[model samples]
Target: MSLQFHNQLTHRVDTFTPQIEGKVSLYTCGPTVYNYLHVGNWTAYIYWDTLIRVLQANGLRVERVMNITDVGHLVSDADEGEDKLEKGARREGKTAWDIASFYTDDFIKGMARLHLLTPQHIIKATSYITEQLELVRTLQKKGFTYQIDDGIYFDTSKFPSYGHFAGLDLDAQKAGARVEFNPQKKNPVDFALWKFTPQGETRDMEWETPIDLLEPIVADGLEYEQANKKMGFPGWHLECSAMAMTLLGKTLDIHTGGIDHIPVHHTNEIAQSEAATGVTFAHYWLHNNHLKVNGTKISKSLGNGYTLNGLGEKGYSPLDFRLFVLQRHYRSEGNFTFENLESAKNRLHNWRNSAALRHQTHDRLRDDDEKSTDDESVSLYASSQALIEAISNDLDTPAACAIIDEAFRKIDGINLEDIHQHALTSFIETVDNLLGLALFDTSKDISDDIKRLIIERERAREKKDWQAADRLRDQIEKSGVTVRDTAHGSIWEYVA
Candidate 1:
């Protein structure tokens, strides 16, 4: 199967082949772990989930690593603000570590509800301080790092291709409206790899660098710092560069984040990573556009960001939001409206109810006599093959899902013969086996039992006897699998 997805770097859809055969490694920027993830941000998660599902559908082994920035992320992208965790601590009246841990747990719980497969590894910035410092040391040794009074900075000019990933020109980022130009910086685009704290402040998470160890820094907040005192942690951009390089290598098969992250955040990562390793940062850079409300981008400071909890307060499930996300291509910004959600929820409910009906019909066919298990198996095998074909094609889930509806309708109009009915049972079994979206209790042995019936139907169909196949197909549909007849054979699958 060939999968074609849009690559932001190339600005076009390209064929996807893994960097290595049968294996792909992906690194996505994870939440900053400072607050509940706003839904706009959660689109990145869902977009990646769909991609991962498609990868699995194509039979590739995927290894994914998403980082947790519990520490080292400053409130401002320019490295001019307080550490975000510390800022959150002040807001919540807790320790910095407490804030980080609290939000990290919250993010994990949200992923559980969203049905996202957990990343193979979840690394945290705080857990890898030594590794981060080592990266700083490497860059410094390689002449890619320059130091200001507060902390070390990565020289973006050291690598000329710094801002291209974000569709940004180098000079534009240096002078962009959102950027802050520091006088101490050698270049306007240089970003901190480390930061010095104002003198005398009690930093709950401060660490001593080689410079700090060498100087007897005075502890006075009003005195202000030209050197490290109580300043805590690395800058956000540098943390990603260091962590991503450490865990997934300097280059990755894919790098994913939101459109918001493109400019300063991901741009800096690309700059620092490539400068540090002198290699490409990522082969494919994918970014999902934002979700908007009434044509404005949804955000928290504007009092417009809604979480899954906030949406549910009005009696909507997170699944409703998930379905809403599915309605649009990931590249396009989707508008969120209560009216839109209502329509989607109605359609979702209709699909499930209709699919379930189709499956119930597949139940009756297993009782066929002379239902040689072989006939049942063949019928099922043929049906599932077709269903799998629909899903594996660029994750055309809507098409694959629609096929279920069509199959149910077709099976509803059929009567049973041994072979035809058996063939129908087999198709039902096939759809269930491949998609894992059937409405049955998968933990129960019902799937196995259904597969056995399908084999009998397949054998019946092979004999060129329509009566037994049709009978078994009807029986299987009665069992809750929808069956359809084709010129080639009979097929069946779960209704919902």
Candidate 2:
């Protein structure tokens, strides 16, 4: 089956055809690195990881680029307020550069813990100031930019398809007196491309632009005077367009982010990029729905936000959280709760145990007999194909997980002696590859103390001493090994 993605630009689930055959050029918006990433932020990365895995599963090479917004991203998406990094520095009592580095390291660690594939190119917004300035210059030269007292602004009226990607009704939005318009802005929807540093205020992240003066060109009743070598910073929307085109060519095969970005951030990107290049900014725009908690958006302001460390403190492995994310469809909103996470934890525990049992059974069979059959290979291939088909249809991870569940049921229902061990192993490994669950690495050697506790727990269970068994189980868990009692015996594994 051909892969399909629901492109936000076209508002349809279109078949994916790469700009270049057998390869994909993908870009995903990275975090602002102002603070610890909450689970809501991580959801976008999880879905993007699944997309990359699915693409690679279909034998396509993916060159993915993700950016770290260390500078220029403001507290308000509307191009007003302090830079987020500077705000974070004030809150934490550190330099803006230090804050960016520290939080970026934390973000990377979180992604690694979640088993997310790191992008091939991880660029920082601060590292590409030259490119950003050049992009602003290009827009200025094209007569698409105008100057105001605050900064260089992109004239939305000049871009005919300004709001096409977001399906924004520009006329109605302009007519409605919903938002306070900037007096210097010609159109209500005009956005900043460059922001001039406040007079007599020194900023840690501001830079001197090459442009000698902000031209005194007047357009739409807005006038400005030239200031030689004005110190300013790039706008939030300009960073992505500059960096993406610098690394991934003028057009990208896929550009993904949270659905929240569709309205402002991504809309501006499309406007500035297409206006400059006169071509499509990206071939496909993929967005994942937000992650919510308790029927509300997961946010720090709500006090419902959680970091990976916070989840770890609650005794949940990162992969358990990853499983929780995968059990739901990316396009659908997922309500996060500890109860749901516990359910996913148990499910993953059971799945890992089943895979471990299969591995043990396969080992025993291999020792006894080395014979294989062509029918077994055919069956394994068919099972793999079914799994791929499930994921390929717009990344239906829930359906793919259901297929794995069915496979496990089939393995359990059939006779162990009659089962082809190699095929079963191959099928399980392939599923793990696609899902990135790390189920096959279940042979983690338990410490001798944990082994002794497991023995005591087993004895307590044999004696029908429920209280003692429960106590030993608690002790085992405190030692960082999860204990699962099986019909055969008690099983233990490290807590990730």
Candidate 3:
């Protein structure tokens, strides 16, 4: 089946067609890197990682870029507040550069724990100031930019289709803003492309604003402070366009972020980039819906923004949260609770147990006279193909998960002697490849000593010697393996 995705730009599910056949250029909005990411923030990353996996599974070579916003992201997500990195520095009593480095390292560690695929390029916004400034200069030359007292701004009035992507009503926005809007801005929707540092204050992450990019009025007027060496920074929306174009090209196959970006951040990116390049910024746009905690919005004041470390303290691994996120469709809003997370944890535990069956499948089949069993035996090969089909259809991860559950249920019903070891191992590989749950890494055969103890325990149970059976079970538990005596036989699992 062909790939399909619900394109936010078109407001419909469109079949995917890369600009170049068999090659995809993708961009994902990354973390701001001022603090540890909450589970809500990690949801987008996991989903996009699955997108990369599915693209590869469909024989497409993906050249992806993810940015780390170390500078210029404001507290308000607009141009009106303090930069997040500088705010983080004040909170932690460290330099803005140091705060970015520390949190960026933490984000990478979290990605490893979650088993996410790394992008081909992980560029930091601070590293590309010159490129960002060049983009602003291009806009300035194209007459799409104007200067106000605070910064250089993009004129939404110049872009006729500025609000088309989000279906925004500019006239209504202007009417709503009559009471408390920036008096200097020409339109209510005009956004900053670059912001100048206030005259009396210095920023930890400022760069010299190019004199040529500044307006003649601002550069020549004596009222402007520090005009010869003005320090400023790129707007939050500017870096993504600049970095994506610099690495990928003028156009991209896919661009992904949270739904909140559509109205402001992404809309502004489209206006500025297409205005500068005279082409569509991205062919397809994918936005994941927000993740709520306990049916409430995740807020700092609520203290409900649980980080990976916080979940670890509660004995939930990153993979458990990953599975929880995948259970819901990406376009649907997800409500997260500890209770819901526990269910996903148990589900992963069961999957690992099923994966452990591969090791025992060979042993059980070796004793049978025929190497293969009945014609009705389960075919994981067909299941693997079905799994890809579900994912290819707009990243239907929930459906794909249901398919896995059904396949595992079939394996559970059949006798162990009938399970094909090679097919089962291949299925496990597909699961790890598509879902990144790391089943193969987590599930393994028990030590031979533990296996012998299980044999003795089985013998004792066959003879109805309950005390000896109990003793052997205790010995097996000491080695961190638990035994479940089903009617079929004894099954061993790790105690994690």
TM-score of each: 0.75, 0.87, 0.96
Looking at model 2, residue 71 earns an lDDT score of 91
Q: At residue 388, give the lDDT of candidate 2.
A: 89
**Compared with the true structure, what per-residue lDDT tens digits does model 1 show for residues 74-131?**
7665676777888999999999889989999999998877767788988888877777
As a whole number from 0 to 100, the lDDT of residue 262 in candidate 1 is 80
Q: What does candidate 3's lDDT look like per residue over 1-496, in tens digits?
A: 6999999989999999999999999999999999989999999999999999999999999999999999999998877788999999999999999999999999999999999999999999999999999999999889999888789999999999999999999999988996655789989889999999988789999998887887654556565545556679999999999999999999999999999999999999999999999999999999999999999999999999999999999999999999999999999999999999999999999899889988877634445544455332346888889999999999999998998888788877456777778778888899899999999999978888999999999999999999999999999999988888876888787776
Off by over 4 Å in 2: 178-181, 216-227, 363-381, 413-415, 443-496
Task: Please tell me which model should have the higher TM-score, number 1 or number 3.
Answer: 3
Looking at model 1, residue 476 earns an lDDT score of 76
Error of 1 at 273 (Å): 1.2
TM-score, cand. 2 vs. native: 0.87
Q: In angstroms, how far off is 413's CA in candidate 1?
A: 7.7
In terms of lDDT, the best-performing candidate is 3
lDDT of 2 by residue, 105-195 (tens): 9999888888888899999999999898899888888999988888999999999888888989988987884665577888888999999
Candidates 2 and 3 compared: the better one by lDDT is: 3
Instruction: Return the lDDT, model 2, position 469.
Output: 95
